[model samples]
Target: MRGDVMGCSSQSTITNFSPQIAEAYAILRGIRFAMDAGLLPAEVEPDAKTIVYLIIADAPPLAEVGIVISDIIHICKHYNIWVLFTPRCANMVAHNLAKVMPAEDLFYLEEYPPYVESFVLDDKAM
Candidate 1:
């Protein structure tokens, strides 16, 4: 969590899944981005404990999010990644970033967005 922000992305999808599913999708997308950028030995700290447990336990996910969990598991298998459960407060930067990002697009930030800058700074100061 102390590393520099390498990149960020947003994906807007039309689906009837719950917010948890959407979060899982976003986490998977981030992992893929990091892998593509050759950022291995990654540690993915997600605010969703269920998703983190599923990945850590290597158990089958519920039907609604099975596909996403599968993809995440596949990526983790190919890289040195650890999916840890992070509290929302500790994950404020990502939470705020998700709020301010455009829909359906992957954005690479050279700098933090204005709205999330404070959150980033707060995390850094911790």
Candidate 2:
């Protein structure tokens, strides 16, 4: 995306939210946002390998977060989306955003949050 963030969202979840569910939700949100913005033929790079495998295989949701994965699959039916799994170390932006954003509110922005600037810079240099 030319070093320009299309949009970033910090989706805070319940105290008991499963990590898998949270990851799936994040991917789901990203897809929906891109679709709404008319950004088709997207490629998603998620750090969760399980979710990526499930989505790619279009597998039935057997896990607790299957519902979210199902939704992601449904949405992909309307457009071309390639889901790839990235190692956490290479996904610094998402990793830092999860650590820094307040759990009480959802954050959406076109620019990297101040807290995430350092990581973004590091990523760009990679």
Candidate 3:
């Protein structure tokens, strides 16, 4: 395993989305990305505790957020996964990036934006 970020991604919703929906969708996307990129045995550290708990409980397969939560549950069925809860303040790089990133889909495989770099370094120091 590498002691560095393998990659990161951000995507626009194309239209307005509620905070909870956006967070669930982003987590779903991140899980799919890791699966697709051959990054097995993944662990997700989410700042949203409720979402994490729902996913951990394997939320129902029906409803809106439940649909996305169900998908995450389904994926871990065949793979190793760990869901860890992290506070927003402890993940400042992610919090800051979400605030300033553009309204478009973007992916960075190791390379990060200049503005994001400092926060990342600060994170490493911790």
RMSD of each: 2.0, 2.2, 2.2
Off by over 4 Å in 2: 1-3, 103-109
RMSD score of candidate 3 (Å):
2.2
* Native-referenced Cα lDDT, model 2: 0.77
Query: How would you encode candidate 3's per-residue C-alpha lDDT over 33-96 as one tens digit per residue?
Result: 7777777788877798888888887765466778777877888777787777788877776777
- Each prediction's TM-score against the native? 0.86, 0.82, 0.85
C-alpha lDDT score of every prediction, in listed order: 0.77, 0.77, 0.75
Measured with C-alpha atoms, the lDDT of residue 85 in candidate 3 is 79
Model 3 segments more than 4 A misplaced: 1-3
lDDT of 2 by residue, 1-126 (tens): 544566676666555668888788889888887776666787778888988999999984877798998889888877897778988888788787767546565545567678778878788777
Candidates sorted on lDDT, descending? 2, 1, 3
What is the C-alpha local distance difference test score of candidate 1?
0.77
TM-score, candidate 2, is 0.82
lDDT of 1 by residue, 33-73 (tens): 77777677888887888888888888756687877888888
Q: Which ten residues in a row have the lowest lDDT in candidate 1?
A: 101-110
Decreasing TM-score order of the candidates? 1, 3, 2
Clashing pairs in 1: none
